[model samples]
Target: MAFLELNDIHKSYFLGKEEFPVLNGIDLQLDRGEFVSILGESGGGKSTLMNIIGGLDRKFTGQVKVDGRQLDHTKEKQLDNYRRGTIGYIYQSYNLISHLNIVENVLVSLDMTTLKGSQRKERAIALLKKVGLGDHLKKRPSQLSGGQKQRVAIARALASDPEIIIADEPTGALDSRNTAEVLKLLDQIAAEGKLVITVTHSQEVANYGTRIVHLTDGQIDGDTRLKPAYPVPQEDQSEFRARPLSAGASYKNAFKHLTFTFWRNSLIMLGTAIGLFAVLLFSGLGNGVNAFIENQINSMVNPNSVTVFKNPTGKKMSSTELQQSMQQFANDPSKLLLTDDQIDHLRDLKHVNKVEPGYQLSTYTVSYNKKNSSGSGIQTWTKAFSDNTIKTGHKPGDNEIVINKNQAIALTSAKNYKKLQGKTVQLTMQWINKKNQPIQITGKLKVVGFSDNAQALAAATNYHTMRQLIEKKNGVTKANYVSVNVTNSIYVKQVAKKIQNLKDNNKYTYGAITVGDILDTINQYVQIAAIVLSAIAGISLVVSALMIIVTMYMSVAERTKEIGILRALGERKKDIRRLFTAESILIGLFSAALALLLAYGFSSLLNHILYKIVKFNIVQISAANIISTVIIALVISFIAALLPARRASRLNPIDALSAD
Candidate 1:
């Protein structure tokens, strides 16, 4: 048995129904240390035979035995291992990756070996030095001369230390002097006890080898021995060996390619960033608007209180229907009033700190020194009113009342509106008793405070003071509404739900409303607007995804030849896929970072401008939004790369190496 054997190999190409044979019934036997030259004409199957031996052309019907172990050509994984471990190819074209420098080009082959970090670099440097190109480690392929390029190719081929080196016209593109130097290098490679097989058409090239096999029309016409084979050396016992390419190597290569054309990729990144920025900006705006609205409402009313009213219909009502029900109070106020039993029940509820029975008249009037101002939303003061509501003075006490800026300026001027404070005014209100009869309640009160808050727009007097005035006017003091104060703000919602769920004979007895509920209704609209804006941003994101897809597809087309080289160097399908996918992911990450910067920068400026007018920051970007942006970017990139990367990985090495 020989070290390497080809047994009755046959390969053919079909053009429709016509079969064109390239190699027919070929049988050869050879051993290591023999530099064998298969000399033939251009179309006489010399290169095809080399491809069969190198494991790059596996579709042929043949049994390639190395050291008596036959290679199963049909198994792609097996062929990949055979090429990765035993075969090294030196192409005539010097097919070096354009983006990689000299040392890096050699390291591309060494990356599949088990050599660790610095060990691989050290070996690649040593190989480049051995080829007499030690000072040109950083130079790219285009910067090197023809002879230097061929030397780089030789270094890369020998990087993995394979058993057999296949040179297909290694000196074909070189002058006589450079050709002599390259042949001397090949002779040195054979002298090192490894099998060297060169495919050539030159008779002088064949004579330099140990044996010359003259191939004519895919058949051996002559076999001549010029010199004996070199002695086989002792097997290397080192643990170093070839393995599959790791994901980290794939990512590193991807990044190298990305930076090689950074300017072109930057456009894709900017477009994606703009789309992401829209999402982030709108999300922040929603947050800011929600906070501002809550702040405005909280400044006028207490958060730890809920209003309890008689549920005359004894059913849950939407906010719209509830507002309509309040309008019904003008015709019959008694029907909207809470009975004494309801007030006591509210006071006894859990988490209830205090319960105040209040009166709300639909309309009221205040006359001071013959100047009158009519108002609505007239309600007695309760715990529901925040202390901050009165910007000028204290809350109404005893015979005192608080008036808003509208009425104060109506009675007095805006500048002298403060003068209305501490001035006596005649307050008159309309209401109804339990008998369903209308009545008039009038009292002479002194204004103590003035405000511009929404809740204090209409004048408010203390509950006890209003009750006294109503009694004095021969009117029944009905409790139209009850303000229930919770022990803590957190308990407001829980207690309110209990009140709204309260039943008397299977019918709800009370309706509860809180500041949080009102804000929640308002926040829904805010969220809808944010979603609409985000949805529009999502349209741009779709376009971004398409952009990414087109970019990856273009990359696959541009790097098709490189893809072929990598596959010939033993890269797996998944590694090729990961290469492209990793680059796209980098694009996504950079875009996300850019979007975050844009969002924060614009938000800062917008908030600064709006804060002076509204007295609040209106754009608040949260940590959650940042994380969501990153996740969206990654998912989009991964999904976008799937098709292009798959197509790139599936390309045929023979055809790919031939691609322009």
Candidate 2:
């Protein structure tokens, strides 16, 4: 059997439902260490024949054997191995990676091989030296002359030291001088005892080969052999020669290609960064909002306190009626409304603090120096809900009453005089008695302190005790609101439970809630807002991911020839896919990191702006944002790169090499 043999090779194509034959039962044979050339017209199957021999184009029928190994209809893995270990392919386009140095370009061929990095580098340098490219090792393809690039390509083809070197129009893009130099190198390669087969349209190229074959419309038209007048002696083969598994070669090729094009992948990373930034921005903002709400609620609440009140009522009664009813019910002897007995019982619970009783009264109209105003009309009335334990106000005296800032403001800014601090104010205490009489008492009370925030009164209902007011307003004894506080915040619920147990059969009934419940409610609302913001960021991320996919696909189209050259030079299909995929993954990881940093910066900027308005310290970042952003970026990148990587790996070497 010949070293490389083709027996009746046949290939066909389809064009609009018509069968077009490219190769018509062509047969050829090549011996080890022979220079053979196939010359043909542009449309002829010379390059196609070379592709079949190179293990790049599989859609053909023929008995193609390399060193007695069958090639036609071979398994994909076997074909891949053959390409990696036995054949070296060079193309007319040079196919030098624009971003890689000549030596690195050559090293790419050993990616899947068992050779380590140093070994690969050594081998690459040796091949470059052999191809007269030793000085140009660090030069990119664009930096080198046409002839120099072709030499680098030839060196890359020799990286794995394959048994056969298949050249498809290797000198097509070169000038006469470069063509002559490349042809001379081919002769030297064959003289080194490797089989050199070339497809070309130049007569001079054909003349350099020991055997010349002509193809017309895919069929062999002329076959001639030239006898050498003087044959040269064979060179010694005691140098580097070994074969590793194809899997190793695939990995090596992927690494080599990725290293060469790493810088170009930054653009994809930028896209990923944009997505990550948006996502982290919203997530961080959400966390900030939640924290702020919690702080606000906690500061206003006594951590160990529980307040008892009616579950929200649906009545829209006037403020006068509400205040009167609350005061009347709380002070009523007939209705037990959280009596002193119930307060003492709740004091026995673990971690019980004070368990102070409290009440609220609204719409108590006051007149100071002819100025008249109602208590319910005050905005800060809620601050007065706290008991005297958290405040310094004295209990209501006979013919005198005390009120919060809301009430003080009402009395101060009534119709007449503005100053009512020490002035006597006429306070009208209205009540509905057992007889349902609209009884009103006019009392003279001194103006006291002003109400601040809700946090000033943690126990509730202590602005001025209603006991004196109830006594003054005869025939009305009742109350509406009540509050309780514990010794320890951790045991606030224990005290609240004791308060609830005081219910059941008691006339004094109420609902109960701890500080934790109030803060929890605020936090829940903040969390919901965060989720909404994060979702908005996610939408932008999705768009960025799609953009990456589209960009990568365009990259694949641009680098089709590069992929073909790599495959012909012994890179596996998996390696091609990995090169593209790695490009995308690197981009994503870079973007994720960048996005996190940007988010941090953006949050600081946003917080500064908010501080000017709200006067509060706000934005904060966490490790969770980093982890989540990275994971999301990786997933988006992998998903986006899937199609482009596959398409790049599946390209037909013959067609790719032939494309302009």
lDDT of 2 by residue, 1-660 (tens): 677789989998889999999999988878877888898889898877877777777788888887787775458777777887788878777877776678778777766466777887888898888888777777888999988988987887777778788888899899999889999999888887788889989988898888888999999989888644124346565345434335444544445555555666666666668767877877777677767766655554456567655422223322333334445554432442344554466566676555555444334676666766655522112321333322334433333344455455544554432254455666665555556466664556565433344233311222243455555677344443445656666676666655554444533344566656666666677778877777876887787788879878988888887777776665667777777776677677778888988888888898999999866657767788778888888888878889999999889866776665
lDDT of 1 by residue, 1-660 (tens): 788999889989989999999888789998899999999999999999998998889878867899999989888898888888888889889999999999999999999999997999999999999999999999999999999999999999999998899999998999998899999999889989889999999998888899999898887888889999988888777558999999999989999999998899999999999999999999999999999989988988899989888877878765445657777755877678777887898878889989999988778999988999988888889889888888889998999899888899999887898888888999988876547677788889999998786454577999889999888867777688899999999898899888888898998888788999889999999999999999999888899999999999999999998998888888888889999999999999989999999999999999899989998889999999999999999999889999999999999989999899
- C-alpha TM-scores of all predictions: 0.94, 0.74
Off-target runs (Cα >4 Å) in candidate 1 are: 316-332, 455-457, 473-476
| Residue 202 in candidate 1, Cα distance off native in Å | 1.8
Candidate 1 C-alpha error for residue 516, in Å: 2.0
